[model samples]
Target: MLYAVVDIETTGGHASANGITEVAINIHNENQVVESYTTLINPRQFIPAYITALTGIDNDMVAEAPYFEDVALQIYQLLNEKVFVAHNVNFDYSFLKHHLAAAGYDLNCRKLCTVRLSRKLIPGKASYSLGKLCSALNISIQNRHRAGGDADATSILFNMLLETDHEGVIAEMLKKSSKEQVLPPHLDRASILRLPNQPGVYYFKDNKGKIVYVGKAKNLKKRVISHFTGNKPNKQRQDFLRTIYNVDYVVCGTELMALILEANEIKRLWPENNRAMKRYEHKYDLYVFEDQNGYLRLAIDKHKTNNKSLQSFNSLLEGYNFLNQLIEKYQLCAKLCYLQKTATKCTAHDNGQCFGVCSGIETVAVYNKRLNNALAELQRLQPSFALVDDGREAEELSCLVVENGTFYGMGYFKDKTYLADGLAPIKNDLSIYQSNSYILNLILNHAAEFPQKLYKL
Candidate 1:
């Protein structure tokens, strides 16, 4: 393939925050240079003193030089339909693309990077800076930072790199270039590119722009990528993936932010695809009654009372199961537990299990004391408390709790100073909150140096 060896000097590092200073494009064909263009650009701003010292192209030299728009098309035609090669492809390409877009053009060119190729072909080189590589390989560089000179030096360097392993190197580079699909169907790579590699929540929105799934990720990009890639996912996974057409995410200073955001989103969107994070019906306060003889009867009852239960259970079966296990562990009698017959001197006392609590042999006060002791042991979790953890970003923290008639996973703030920031209730779909199951594991899982603290309301 023909090569357009291009080098550009910019006013500053950021693509959006700066303008181009000088640009040079040298087009080369098989073993010969075909065409080349070089010019200082009127950046319309004072060049930094350091930049002037480096490039030696002061404001005076480019004073009358045409702005980027005047020469864009000329260079476009010259390098048109040719391979866009550069040292650091993203930096150069991003600058060019931004400048071109501002000048009323959108050029999406296929780019190849010599830096990556050098890393693979010539392995274990400490620094891959263009000047460093050229010096190491005995290539002469006339002008250090001038665009024309750098482009010329790059032209020579490209020849040397090609000669190093002509066929083998090109083949590998092409394979890698192929892996980068400029734009995939129904998604913008920008969706995942800038996502911070910290714990946070992400939303999968459908074509109608409605959220379909709410998910929390320790690494948002990687988790989203997993859904898009991989060999056929399971049935449920496939359904979740199908509903997702685009992704929107927030960067939390910490996992705590992600957890809270996820809870809020799920509660709000009520997305069709999310099976988790959505709310579920848990058994409310359990029943503890006393028999005619004052024997404590532990009963599994769901009265829909507002008082927090001993423990939340997903189903009545689970509640029953846990209660039965607790009964067995404490050596409590089924008769006193209200599990079997409605006898007075409970059947368990008759069966030699109950310590005659149903009869006068065991004092009412003593038996009830023992039963209360067991109940206290079983109800270890706080009725209502905030679980404080790290926030999604630096200087941030999280507060998770169930209070004032709601279950909130996490709330965010810019810094710890706002730890007591007033929380606006997060209304999330019951399913969205359920998707945060892993967070429970994360918070409870790590308790060594940083233990998750719980503060009661």
Candidate 2:
């Protein structure tokens, strides 16, 4: 029940080199185009020899023809409330949009393409260009490539392709091609439909005005739509899309730029679905909890705000258990470290295994000295350092670092607008963990030409 099977003759090849010369629409319903129209307009310039030879409409033929504005109304009436079916919908639709934009009339319509549908429905066609498609599909064109004739062919081919089955292919391609993926109802299609597939950060927000999820991708729109298609998904991604009333995006020039932008925005908005920031891993684990009895109890608590601990573990039990095994191996004290504080003779001493203070078996001074030796086994996460990385450029990535905070990381800046002089200015970021890790590792690897220089912030 669609209206227009449309085609247009353009001035030339590249859209930037052209203007629409002839317009035609064949209106059809129930698989029949009941009405048809066509017009040639003065393109306000000389028609090239190739175009003249192709369409058989020359410069002299349209030298005195009506201008586009003269016939815009008729074109609108014919195309209004109609599905715009064309060979390559993008070319035709883009040309049409440009024409309408210049003439102060907005042309927005649902678009369907014969090419995509033909690929899906009819299998063996070597080509889908209007000329070849007609020959391949056994449909004949009277004037070949002329505006009205091409449209008539597309209309016939649209019906014939549908005859081959794959019942919903037309509708599905029509829905996807007519607009960008999953747009908010109020926002117009062309707004994001024209977004270049460059690297960028994208944001999704809810009706009550809170950011639900933030992400970055080398292909912005493609990545954003993955949440909707449920291809490879998570529950958080699903829930966010369900509640997303709007989408907002920024186009970064490169992947490195996208990386920084994503980190910055996630920290700023603190989206509910972002899980990387809140999770923190342990740095140091093996430590002594000095009890009030002047006895050292080897526990697995990470060193506090003061001194660094030996290592990190998932739980205190694992730490003490590991230390206990080491204790038995070293034949050390159960009582001197207060492990059996009430024993008259230490558990280890009773078994002739104690090197402990129980029963005056060992001195605290020597025990404390050996305890420092076990502390050497742990690796400590650095407190304050600038983790330099690649910045976004032809031979670059970027740098991110934390100064005096747990959550802060830095951004990139340039001394000059040209950015050809030296290194950019440093901007620290806060509350970004995944990006910090990504910067600390992934982005830095991209800058392999130079070694990373760790500096105290």
Candidate 3:
């Protein structure tokens, strides 16, 4: 296999916005370097001080050098039909892909990451940075940050991996990549490559632009790639893959937000392939009702969108189990909770577990008071509240708004003063979603840990 061991110094982190200042490619044919190329390219933009300090490539050095557009064709021809190998292949591949696209060349090459290879072949290292790894392995690097020097060092390291690859892990990785290479033909590589590695919700749309599936991911890029690569591709998964023409994602502030948004979007879109999430949409609801004899009773029932529920469960069995706990904790009547069917009295009352609300032995007024207390215990401590959490970035804060025991929506704010007034001024910022038992449970589950501050609205 011809491996193009590549490296590049960029103007910035973003592939679309940034330009490559210097790049190098060392073509290896398993045994030795067969061909090599390196150049300083004028990025057409001023390199930041921090970047120049690291890469040692200043504007003056690249001022008269060929622009990326000028060298795009040559680079494309050299790298095409070769495994695009690099330390962190994505960084180099994304940069090259973006620039090549702009230069009217569609460059699609198979990739092999040396960092990943080293992690598998040479385990238990303190650091994995190219310089650190090379130093630890005693692979000398002359020009630490220069693209050509780094590329040559990486090529040497890649050769070491080739020698040390005893378990055929590299071969397995290539096979996996080969499968992914064809699974979703219409899904563009650029879109998948650009997916941010963060918590988010993603939508898979068909050729007609209809969402066929909705999913949540803690790491958007990793999760989405696993979808296309990791699974064994069962009939259902294969069918799902066939229908997917594109994917779009929304980055969330936290995992909790991503989960909530996923549930909401699944309910809203009712995506055909999202059976798992759809099943949880309205599974079971805990409801409080007044019986014919004017006693407040609690029951677990199949969820309906119109039903006002205290909380939700993914299954009827789960709802029953939770209700059983509440009944025992509060000495609530089994008959009242639909756990007993006897008309005269409940087994709980007979066993002294219940307060005899099922029979005349306990006064109705006293029994009803205890029932109300139990219900109150189940209600949120703060009826209308906002959960303030870390937003997508450091300067912003995420707000999960709940108004009068119902979740309104979620939004982010930079100003602390806006939070003081309670979700009114930032209402425009919030993307409203319908309140559901699942999301209510999401809030309760997250609030259990007390990870975020709660403010009464």
Point to the candidate with the largest lDDT: 3
Tens-digit per-residue lDDT, 1-457, candidate 2: 6658888887775344466788888888846879988888888877889988889888888887788888887777777678777776655665666666567777777766676566557757776677897897689997887898888888898778666755776666456555432332222344355555768888777767677878888888777655544111233433443466567787665676577677667777888887784343443365666666555556555535465554445556766686777577655566644456674877666667776566665666676666555443322233444445444444543344543323244444442232233222344222244333444444445444433444444
Off by over 4 Å in 3: 1-183, 230-233, 281-283, 314-333, 346-370, 373-385, 402-407, 422-429, 435-438, 448-457
Each candidate's root-mean-square deviation in Å?
20.0, 20.8, 20.3
- Residue lDDT tens for model 1, 1-457: 6878889998776566677899988887746568888988998888898888888988898899999999888867766677777776556666777778777776665565676656655767666788998787787888888888888888887776777775585554455333322222234445766666777788878768988888888888777666654323134543454345578887765665566566667777888877655654444335787677667778777635454345555567777787778666776766666566665776657666677765668788887888888987765543444556676555665565554323545555454334343333322311124322244434544333354465445
Please report how far candidate 2 places residue 116 from its true position, in Å: 0.8
Ten-residue region with minimum lDDT total, candidate 1: 427-436
TM-score rank order: 3, 1, 2
Error of 1 at 382 (Å): 5.3
Summarize candidate 3's per-residue lDDT along 2-113 as a digit string, tens digits: 9899999988875656789999999999888999999999999999999989989999999999999999999999999998888867667768887888899987787777
Model 2 scores worst on lDDT over the 10 consecutive residues at 415-424
